[model samples]
Target chain A: MKTCYINGTGCISTQNTFETDFLSEVTINNTENVIYANQPSYKEFIAPAASRRMAKGVKMGIAASSKALKDANLTMPEAIIIGTGMGCVEDSEKFLKSILDNKEEFLTPTSFIQSTHNTVGGQIALGLQCKGYNFTYVNGAVSFETALLDAKMQIENDEVESILVGGIDETGTYTLSLHKLINLVKSEEDKPYSVLNSNSKGIVHSEGAGFFVLENEKKESSYALVEAVSLQSSLETEEVSDFIANFLEANNLKISDIDAIVLGNNGDVEFDDYYDISNSLFKNTPQVYYKHLSGEYNTASAFGFWIAANIIKNQDIPEVVSMNALKKEAYSTILLYNQYRGKDHSLIVLKKC
Target chain B: MEALKQELKGKIIEVLNLEDIAVEEINDNDALFGDGLGLDSIDALELIVLLDKDYGIKLTDPKAGKTIFQSVETMATYITDNRTK
Candidate 1:
């Protein structure tokens, strides 16, 4: 089986991650319960005529994919696959509200046309004029990881040498209001959110798009060799330590072998313990987390993946991302573990090239 | 005619969520698609809704919008001609 390598990556998030030297001017958002992406100059990445029909999610996906392709020095990929949890919610909300508010009297097809979950992936393929394999997964939190796994399978089977994969989510107005009503949003009293804190009941909801170009060949910009990636639908907090141990062991790795461990801790009191258990297991290792910067979403784990890829490429862990003060002498092998709402557990192991 | 054109631009901006754009930015003779205002297939749909919702015009085929929505002037003319309400 051929090893898969991430050649290029692009992110559009609450931060200005699309512009050149974007990471230099990072803002740590602590107040807002719902944050939207600091958008890119879509006109640069997309033609105005083509962008008119794209929903925010589709626009974000296309821009991110275009940036990824440019970074990877590739024009088009052999396949396009994407993962989105609440796909095209803005368009969906528009359509549904129009039906209710107008009594279905004279509805048009814009929202309904763009509301499909696969629209982003379909739009990307159409923009690239790529007719190869296309797929979109809507399995909540595991959506992006499922896309990665499918891309890996294709690479191993030699079905495609290069693939464009992404995870994207966009904030919708009424749906976000519904989330707020359910206390999915942090209450006013829940100000100054901290991911490691134990007092929180829910996360600070945010949205972003992260895209990567995965190829069979290792290049100069290859972040890391994708050692292995595994996903589980359910697991108890107690099972997490052993889960990591077995996952590492299966890959012929030990806890001590992991130079740095990147975790996904969304600050929810109920579910953050999953990270706590795994943190205890790798407490001595160089530990890091990024949801505070990326914020929490179904596909926010993609941000963590982006962080892991950068750490492996730069061979230096960003001090801003460290959950603990412990530092590693040489950042080599990294393990990224993330789960959402006590489900969709994922383990991604990466090794420096 | 001028009122209808301004109304059409307003509805288009509102329905499309052109947060960065203003009504005055759209000229009546500006091409609604392509290089004029840079709208695409999706914006066409949103404008299609604007026709139905505001002017009581229902166009079943999106292709019919090509000529009808070429410009604000064209859209206003079509709505004036075919509006049911």
Candidate 2:
């Protein structure tokens, strides 16, 4: 079996991820319950004519994927896979609004055509003229992990030499309001929002896109090796410890073998207990968390994945994302755990190349 | 006729989302497809809907759009003759 290496990564998050170094300039925003992605100019990656009808999610995906491919020094990939939770939702809202306002008449085809969940994958393929096996996964919070697993399996089996995988989710006006009404978004009273040790019941909602290029061979640009990925639909708070143990065991690893652990603690008082269990289990390991920087989104785990990749590549972890005061002599093997509202649990292991 | 042509240019620009293209850049004789304004089949469908919604011109034959949408001059003429609203 061939090894799957993360050759390149591109991330667009609430922080200045796209244009800056690895978490060089970090801001902890607890004031607003909802945050927006720090958008980079798309003119460099997408043509104006082609981008006129694209939604924010689509533009971000294109830009991030372009950066990932360029960073990997590959112009084309044999496959393109995307994982998006909401998936071009702004266009979905626009199309729905036009239907309601115009009495289902005079509806333009642009918004309706761009509203599909596979729009990002299709658009990326179109831009690259890549007619390869393009797929999009929409399995809630595990969407990104699912896509990563698919690409990893294909590369391991020698099905493809290189693949582009990404996870994208964007905030829409109507959808954000609906989430707020349902109390999925943190209330104003929960100001000074912190992802760690927060008493809030809801999340600080945000949007972002992260893309990576995976190849079969390790190169100088390789960031890390994808060791394994595990997904579960649901897990109880008590079962969390055993879950990580069993996963590491399957990968011939133990808790002590992990150098650092990237946790998905989104500060939801009700569900963060899952991380608490792992926190105690890996108390001595270097701990890292990113939701406070990226906010809570379905594919926010992708941002966490990006952070882990950079940590392995740079051989140093940014202090801004450090959850504990612990330090590691070397980050050889790292584990990533993410869940949302106590469901769609995922565990991914990455290692230095 | 001049006012209608200018109106057609503006509407086409707005509806098609030609953000980089200005109204002054589009001449009445410029082709709306292929070599001229570079409009595609998708843009053609949008123009069809625009005609129906704004000018009350429902084109029964899709083949006629090839000629009717040749230029701003052609579209203005077609709307002037066929507009029911």
Candidate 3:
């Protein structure tokens, strides 16, 4: 199969990813249990009237995708693929609240129409006037990985040359409340939360949108070569080593071939072990973790992917993201592994273009 | 009748989330959609709910909204004739 090239990338996260230099000036925001995205000026990217109806997720996706296309110099792609855990959640809450508030009498359609999981994809297509194959995946943490795999497969098959793929999620008031009540979010008193060495029961929840433009051919701004991607719906924490070994072996690589390892460590005591147990297999390898900077969300791994690609493109891993003192002679190939709560584990390998 | 029209403008602005538009700017006979206020189908649905919720008027057919929601004058006239609460 031909290699899938990451021609462009854009990220809007809790750390001013949209307008900053790759964590150069990142200030950890542990003051809140739930962090909001560091937003760009939406008026520059969207019309005021159009933006008024958009939830943060949709707006972020639009801005990110637009920036990605401009960075890749692509006006329109052949396909648009999106992955999201909870889609248009603000609209979902609004629609549901109206249903209850009026006793099912006077519900409006604006929020209802925007609440669909595919709204981001559909709206992007509408904006671009690109009437091509579009899809949205919503399989929990693996949602973004699923879209990435599909885009990769399509590019490898030569069915499409260029594609827009993104993973986006937004916070909703009611949704956050539910997560807090269920202990899925870090406790209120857990502010100043440290993602690496925490005794917390849950992660600091946040929101973000990460988008990438993938093409069959590498461009001047191409970030990396997407060598391989793998997903496992369920895996015992003990089985992670063999799972990675098989993936690396299939790609004609080995554990030593990996330059850096990006692990999803969100400081949930129960699940940080998923990342910690892998430490033995990659003990000598330079390890990196980004949830500390990006915050823990379903598609936050997409931010990890952005970081990995940038690491390969620039050949320097920011000290802010390093999990340990280990270093490589030249940061060439990067392997990113992410999962949530012992499920939806995905492995993606990226090599310098 | 004039008071109802003025009240409808405020209600429309509040319900539809038209933050940029002021009540004084909307003429009683001006169109509520397309060329006038630039409202769309979605806003029409919101107004449908507003009519039902605030005036006890039920509109099951969406096409009926095209006539009743033509302007603040028409909406106020409809509410004065059919209001239940």
Interface RMSD of each: 3.0, 0.7, 1.1
Top candidate, metric lDDT: 2
Against the reference, the lDDT scores of all candidates come to 0.86, 0.94, 0.90
lDDT of 1 by residue, A145-212 (tens): 99989998898788999999999999899988888899877777888877777487888899999999
Which run of 10 residues does model 2 chain B get worst, by summed lDDT? B13-22
DockQ class, candidate 1: acceptable
lDDT of 3 by residue, A1-353 (tens): 66799999989998888887777679776778888898899888877777778888999999999999999999999999999999999999999998898898777888898999999999999999999999999989988999999999999999999999999999999999999899999887776688888888899899999999999998898999888999999888888888898999999998889899999999898888888644598999999999988888889989999999999988888899989899887888999999899999999999998
Better of 1 and 3 by lDDT: 3
Query: Candidate 2 chain A, which ten residues in sequence have the lowest lDDT sum?
Result: A272-281
DockQ, candidate 3, comes to 0.70
TM-score of model number 1: 0.90
Off by over 4 Å in 2: B1-3
- The model with the greater TM-score, 1 or 2, is 2
Model 2: residue A315 alpha-carbon error in angstroms = 1.3
lDDT of 2: 0.94
Instruction: List the RMSD of every prediction in angstroms.
Output: 2.9, 1.5, 1.7
TM-score, chain B, each candidate: 0.89, 0.98, 0.94
What DockQ results for candidate 2?
0.83
Q: What ranges in model 1 sit over 4 Å off? A: A20-22, B12-51, B57-84
* Quality of model 1 by C-alpha lDDT: 0.86
